[model samples]
Target: MHFELGFVLLFSIATAVAIAARYFKFPYTVALVVAGLTLGVVHAFEPPHLTKDLLFAILLPGLIFEAAFHVEFRKFWKNKLAIHALAIPGVVAAVGVTALILSPVVGGLDSVRDFGFIHALVFASVIVSTDPIAVVGLFKALGAPKRLAILVEGESLLNDGTAVVLFTLIVAVAGGAHFTVGGATMDFIRVAGVGALIGGGIGFAISQVIQRVDDAMVEITLTVIAAYGSFVVAEHFHYSGVIATVVAGMLCGNWAASTSMSPSTRVAVESFWEYLAFALNSVVFLLIGLEVQLGSLLASWRPILLAYVAVVAGRAVVVYGVSALLRFTPERMPWSWSAVLTWSGLRGAISMVLVLGLPEGFAHRELLVNMTFGVVVLSIIVQGLTMAPLLRRLGVSGLKDVYQEKYELARGRVGAIHAALTALEALRRTRDIPADVVEQLERDYQQKAAAAEQELSALKQQTNRFHEEEHQEGVRRMLIVEKDALLKAYQRGVIGKEAFEHLVAELDERLAKVKDPEGHVPLEQSSPSLPDAA
Candidate 1:
């Protein structure tokens, strides 16, 4: 196929699968993968040849940036311990265990009989990093806890760099590069540290530049430069590009987004990145499906099945074991959270990229690639499909938070009524309004106020029956919204800086209290009045 035609077909497939995903409430990436597989099976069109430069240099940076940009910095910090534990050591453990378990069986498989522990380790390293796109998408759609999502996402973002480094080092060892524990450790540290420093420096520089510019287009363009440029620059110096991209993204998201860019510019930048991620993800997952060698996969079915079991087992050990170890820490993870984390360790594009990059004559390269593809498929199809149901079973599904939504709606109605009444009173005093007009407006406002009051009262009564945790979550969410509104009001010059700062501080205090279970106070119990909108 002509390059343009192939691009168009891929995009068209992405669009169709996206629509189908939405219509059927399926995870978008999972749907795309399935669609790609279906197309491949029927030999509908040639899979677009995804080059390493295209995948890593072009597509990956945007996806990483988008994920890192949206991560809630506070939540990420709160869960940093668990996230790092699961990402760094967790990745290593998964790789090691996979190699150990798969090594003995390698000699029994004709395709991989020549492969040994070192080769198996290289394969394990390729597949160890979990792909956050599909699982995180499902988590968002299912309304999983914000912290849970952050943990999963933060781990994935960080682990990709670690996995890539490990893969590189292992591949080098397999190809006659000298290896020592001390040397490997130093190399890992150097790569990760350098990548982070470069990324942070680039991010901070771009953020500073962005603050001096108010044009949304310029600001968005600067961000684009930061994402791709940081990755490319770091990679050129033999640093971990994935780490660089992630750090740059996190900086842009938490710092530049709030402090440097105007609200409009921030929104535009975010929307652009969001769309970029969606488009890239669509292409990546679809290509994963289209590029699968079904015959090779079938030929290696025995080893692939064994690898799948090993992968799952590795994930379970990491999640359950880490959670257990962290049980006494501030970041102690719940067993339910660990369960979701375990099942969500889905492999995708990164694994495929690593395996495909293997040397053409490398022993077991084809077998490893097919097995990695099989594991990715199983993870996306089986685990992705069941994530929502699992959340529901564990009682953490977003549906359980309906009370919080109802409370917000009720509060919005009350606030709107108040605003309308205040506006009506101000207009009556300032303008030459007729008595009839004033009376009708006053009556309308009064009825709406009454209805809003009733609704708010009913919602409060209903929500009072919620479990303590749920009630606290509702209070925390309300406080966050209130703080956000105050900040926006300040940004728009609707409120003075002093008032905004004071109000936000007050809200923060309340938020802290609500978050603290020991001294928790419900919003209604603590303060019946909303923050002054003036």
Candidate 2:
């Protein structure tokens, strides 16, 4: 009953938060934290009995499996550079700087354990890993340019593995194990290599399994197994669990998307993961928000604040400095990417989880936990809330957000048709098809295809309208739905407000183009381009 009640409370709060976020334009993370904190305080005396282990056990696999099962490997390969920068070195820099800058406050705080620099660095290490899951809602809601969003999200996902591996290494060192920077580098590389190999291996095996089975249930179940199993196996071997999941998801999501899995199975798997990710994210962040005791933090606010300032400064340096060494092009990577990377690099659930997971009675554990919570809160509320607006100010907008939206909608329709056709063929092999019935089936397919085309046409028209500077009536009618989707996604924690507002502007511009009609180009024909979101 308690278990059931917990989920119910979670679902209800998530649903409410989703609705509220749509209207408020506050960071979804911020709103959720505030909402959760309010509820947690109210129920502080009788807090929900959600164990960290069950959460890792049940939700982790489902969430990971779903993401891996649908990732577009080809697309991931295209933006691998940005993904690497943000995921690897970015994490290292953030951790190093955060620990160094925040040491005085953490060490000086009278109540918390006094910490040596190494321990402080461990604190930085744990806290620097960003929780992409917490902020994915913002990405999808605003229709951030798919590539940019992909980089942020993909980096976050992969970096979790990197962070996990690094966390392990640091924890070992902090435990009085001998450590050298060179050994750390080798350990990091080896873990990453092993993780990739294992995840890719799982993806290949799953792909084969998918091809041999026509059962949607079987295929979907296999996908679920693939996600969690891969992570578990990777972690068991002390490899990068997150990277394994990312690889597995990319392989299954893209390679086998049109090839192996039935459409029904894909839908079931996607739906399951989507809900699972949402639920898991809710529990994780909600706990982070609720677990925070204000008094514990306010007592040492000075050093925490100074540490935060230094961390941000470090982020700025990392962003600018790293970009110089990397192969990121000004045209492709854009300066805006750097700016958003610095600001949107909010750390939350991961930090909280790491802090809580540290060994009980560990030296400086209390101080570390408190400071970790402090930085996590600041990142989520301060950085998360303002990420979108900051992106707009940097002249980066979610203009091509429609491409992914339209593409997803179209892909779904196409996938369904393909699956249905496969089923129909299978049925035909087993039974005689009457001439009239065959004709009827063909006609039915035509109707379905026609309907899909009509929907695509409408979407394309809306897309075209957004690109145009003038007006058209037909475009305006289409925009009502588009705008609503953007708004709903933002509200639902599927995208960020900055992303939403930027896309909304584009949609409005398209509506204007339709109204004017003369300068308009058809959405289908016009290649999508990135514009100054501001």
Candidate 3:
């Protein structure tokens, strides 16, 4: 197929898959993978081979930035020890165990027995990095605990960088580059440390410029530059571009988003990144399916099966071992959480990119690639499909009941009515709308608000028959969301300043009543307020 036609075909498939995913309540990433696999199996059209440059240089920065940008910095800090343990040491442990277990098996295979330990380690490094896109999507859809989601997401972002560093070092050993423990440690620190420093520096500089500007378009453009620019710059200097991009994104999200950009600019920047991430993810996952070589994979089933088992075992060892060591901490993790963590560590695009980037004539390259593909496919399909049910089995399922949805809807209705009243008042004051129309609108809004308020009151009473704590948490989340909506409306000029302040004050007061004296809501609370509208 011609390049233009191929691009259009792939995009059209992505669009169809997205719609189907929504309709079926399927995880979007899994759906894309399945769609790609179906097309590949049917030989509908061959996708162009994915290059390492295309993935790391072009697609990866945006995905990493968007994920890191949305990470709750406060929550991340709270779980810093656990996240770091998993992301840094956890990666090392997983890699070592996988390589150790698979080395002997690879030695026995006739096609690639000579590849030996270092080659096995290289393959291990490729698959050890967990991609949390599928897992996190399910977490959001199922309303898992906020802290749990944060830990998983934070760890995944960091581990990708770690895995990449390890893969690079192992590849060096396989390619006859000298390796020593001391040298490796220093190299790891330099790659990660420098990347972080550069990313932070670039992010801070961009934020300073953003604070001085009010144009949404320019601000959005600057953020786009920051994402891709930081990654490219870090890579140019041989630093870990993944880490640099992640740090830059976090700084932009937590600092620039709140302090530097205007509300409108912030919203635009967020929306732009969100769309970019979605598009890139769509293409990446779909291509994963189309790129699968089933015959090669089937031929390597023995090693593929063995590697899958090893990967799972490695994950279990890391998760359980880390949680055990951290049991003495103030915030002790539950065993159920450890189990979830182990199962949720699905590998994806990064693994494929690393495998595909292996030098030609490298020992067992084809076999290793096939095995990595099998593992990735299995992880996305099997683990992704089972996560929700597993959450339910563990009794940590965050699914909200129908009454809770109705209550939330009622609260939203009240907020919407208030916003309409505020807009009507503004119009009347300016005489942009006639007094009669404004009065009539006010009456209509008032009636709707009263009805919604009454319904909410009844729902509040109904909560007494259910889990009081859960119900209260839901109410608190609803209030937070309503406050955010009010702020956005004011920012967008849909609500008057006075009304926005009033509504926000009311929400804050309500939130205060529900929260503990320390102002910390339980981490187990579900359905956090939506992102503050720019």
Best by TM-score: 3
lDDT of 2 at 516: 26
Error of 3 at 256 (Å): 1.4
Candidates' lDDT values, in order? 0.83, 0.70, 0.85
Which ranges in model 3 have alpha carbons more than 4 Å from their true place? Answer: 110-112, 411-451, 465-467, 470-534
Look at candidate 1 and give me any clashing residue pairs.
Answer: none
Which residue ranges in model 1 land beyond 4 Å of their true spot?
Answer: 401-404, 412-454, 466-534
Candidate 2, residue 518: how far the Cα is off, in Å: 25
Ranking by lDDT: 3, 1, 2
**TM-scores for every predicted model:** 0.82, 0.74, 0.83
lDDT of 2 by residue, 1-534 (tens): 376776677767777887887687656557778877787667633445434465456655566666655556665665666677767888788778767766766666665455667887777778666665545556656555566666667667777777777888889898889999999999999999999999999988998988998887787777777788888898788787778877888788887757776667778767877777767777666766777878788876866676678667777777767666553342145566777767767776656676678899788677677777788888888787776677667666554565656755875896787676676776677667765676678678767877886776666676664334223445665776787666666767787767877887787666544532211122322223433333
Q: Tell me the TM-score of model 1.
A: 0.82
Model 1: per-residue lDDT, tens digit, 1-534? 887898899998899888888888878888888888888999998767666877987788998988999887876776777889998888888889889888888666765556689878988999999886777776666667777878889999999999999999999999999999999999999999999999999999999998788999999899999999999999999999999999999898999889988777888988898889888988899898888878778888888888888888888988898999887665775688889898888888888888889999987777778888898888888888888889889966665467777776877888988988887888888877886798898998899889888877777776555356667877877876787677677667798767766776687577656754322122322222344445
Residues 84-107, model 3: lDDT tens digits: 999998999989988888888768
Candidate 2 residues lying further than 4 Å off, grouped into runs, are 1-4, 22-28, 48-52, 104-114, 327-332, 399-534
Backbone clashes counted, model 1: 0
